[model samples]
Target: MINPFAPIGRGVLGVLAEIGRFTAFAARAAASCFAPPVFAGQLLRQCMAIGYYSLPVIGLTAVFIGAALALNIYVGGARFNAESFVPNIVVLGITRELGPVLAGLMLAGRVSAGIAAEIGTMRVTEQLDAMTTLSTDPFKFLIAPRVMAATITLPLLVVVADIIGVMGGYLVAVNSLDFNGATYLRNTFDFLENQDVILGLVKAAVFGFIIAAMGAYQGYNSSGGALGVGRATTNAVVGSIVLILALNYLITAFFVE
Candidate 1:
């Protein structure tokens, strides 16, 4: 007789095993972060790579998203004669939800993949082994800096995203939707609260940590050769995105409910 549940059981076990391994990796990285002869230069470089260089893409994305969101909300609100609520709703949506989530997803695709590819290539070339021989701790020198950089910089990125997104919505509303610029701006500020922005920033920080950690974890474990590096890159992006989305919901619920 075929054991129908065997595959399901195996899948569950595999997932659990991966989770366990990732948790252990994260713990080790965290320990190294605190015990480090801190690499300030590397951390600064990573911050620029992960945060500064990402601004253009993140800004472009935010602008388009905000514009599209305003258009959609305006169209929907027209049906109920609630068009006056557009500015308030757009700002609220951007700050409380869309800003952080979109920024995280973007970084997962860009930064996470890059980290994985770089580290995976090093691993394949036995560079990490050489580091060990040179008495340089890979976790402290490589992983900790990237992880700390992401965690610290993500919130800043999200803040910029929020501002740009709000501005995009304002532009759309005032220009395309026949809204008074002053009135729209006033409504946006009036309706937005500090807590809403705070929640999004918090989510950004968490998502940043997840992106870098997943990338480092996948790359550090990868073997084989080019194929392995490619696989690690894919896994890092996929894992970071999935975890970001899942955790976003949990954080939102915690804050809102």
Candidate 2:
């Protein structure tokens, strides 16, 4: 007789196994970051690719998010004659929460998927195997640099996003909301604290590690061929976004309390 609980057991076991594999992969990647024979060139390239190339989308997303956030806050505040708090709330939301979370989500879609596809293709084509035969550690040569670069660059991106996001709120507040430009700027500046910025950057760094690790892990384990690579790319993005949201809450809770 077929056991009714067998399917549930299998699903739970599969999830546990996947979690174990991912944990081990992340540990190895973390260890590889400090190992010798650093790939300076690859690291630099990845920094440029992950950081510089990511600015346009990050900027646009921040600006739009800030603008929309300002508008919503203003409308909500107007209901209770609290409209003057727009600048304060906008700045706080951008730096403390929205900026890092949005940036991480955007990067998970862009960087994680790209990494998976690039590495997955390489895997399917046996390039990783070739590197192995040539005495090159794929972890050192490929994964480590990408992982380290992502970790290093994301905080910088969050800083820029925070600035642009505040600027976005500033523009809307001045042009449409008819607030005194100087007062709006002053409110924003005064309300923003170093702690908020630091918190966001800390979140960004953790999100970065998750993004790169998920991508490389999915790509490295991918089999089959083109179809499999495509599937891995999808999984990388999905996994990164899930982890990003979950960790954001945990980090915020830890620091906020």
Candidate 3:
């Protein structure tokens, strides 16, 4: 028989250590972000890589989610003659919840894996060592730009996702579900508040931070050459998704009331 308390204590200590490392890395990234001879070119490339390239996947996810959410709500709401709530449900679900969450997860997979692989490759090739030898701050030059680009671009992506998602729901409701387009539009506009949109943007920003930071942190701290880099990439993606879900709940509780 094993000691339950021993396992619990180890788990707690491991969590504390991870928290400590994460906090230190965040502080370093924040410092680098503010004090910069900014890498505008690199940042722009990252924006394109992270935002523009991600649109199709994000858009498709949002559209299907919006459609299915409409169907689900319509079916359930009709039980109480609440079919009119479809518009409200679509707008609220997309703008206030699914839009940010899905976008973050998608980007986490794309952006995080890219960051890890790129940085990991550099690490394997000793390019990072060269930068250190030249007195270049890898944290500032390598990590900061990615973090800032992700942090800025995610909100933009979320905005696009929100619009596309709502449009998707509208299409399905009007064409497939036999609802009037004008009434659907009016209900969507009337039911969703400014706070809903603003809250989503906020969540997007937080998710972005999580994605970039986790990727950078894992890649930067990676070990054991090729195998290690691969492991780091996998860990970064998984970690970002888990953290995004956890943060979503916290943010929802704060905003939903």
RMSD of each: 0.8, 0.8, 1.4
**lDDT value, candidate 1, whole model:** 0.94
Stretches off by above 4 angstroms in model 1 are none
Candidate 3 lDDT, 24-139, residue by residue in tens: 99789878988867888888888888888998999999889988888898899999999989999999999989999999999999999889888888888888999999988888
Give a tens-digit lDDT track for model 2, residues 1-257: 99999999999999899989999999999999999989999999999999999999999999999999999999999999999999999999999999999999999999999999999999999999999999999999999999999999999999999999999998999999998999998999998889999999999999999999999999999999999999999999999999999999999999989
Tens digits of lDDT, candidate 1, 33-144: 7884999999999999999999999999999989999999999999999999999989999998999999999999999999999999999999999999999999999999
Q: Output the better candidate (2/3) by lDDT.
A: 2
Evaluated at residue 224, the lDDT of candidate 2 is 97
- In candidate 1, list every pair of residues with a backbone clash: none
Query: Which runs of model 3 end up more than 4 angstroms from their true locations?
Result: 1-4
In terms of TM-score, how similar is model 1 to the real structure? 0.98
1 or 2, which is superior by lDDT?
2
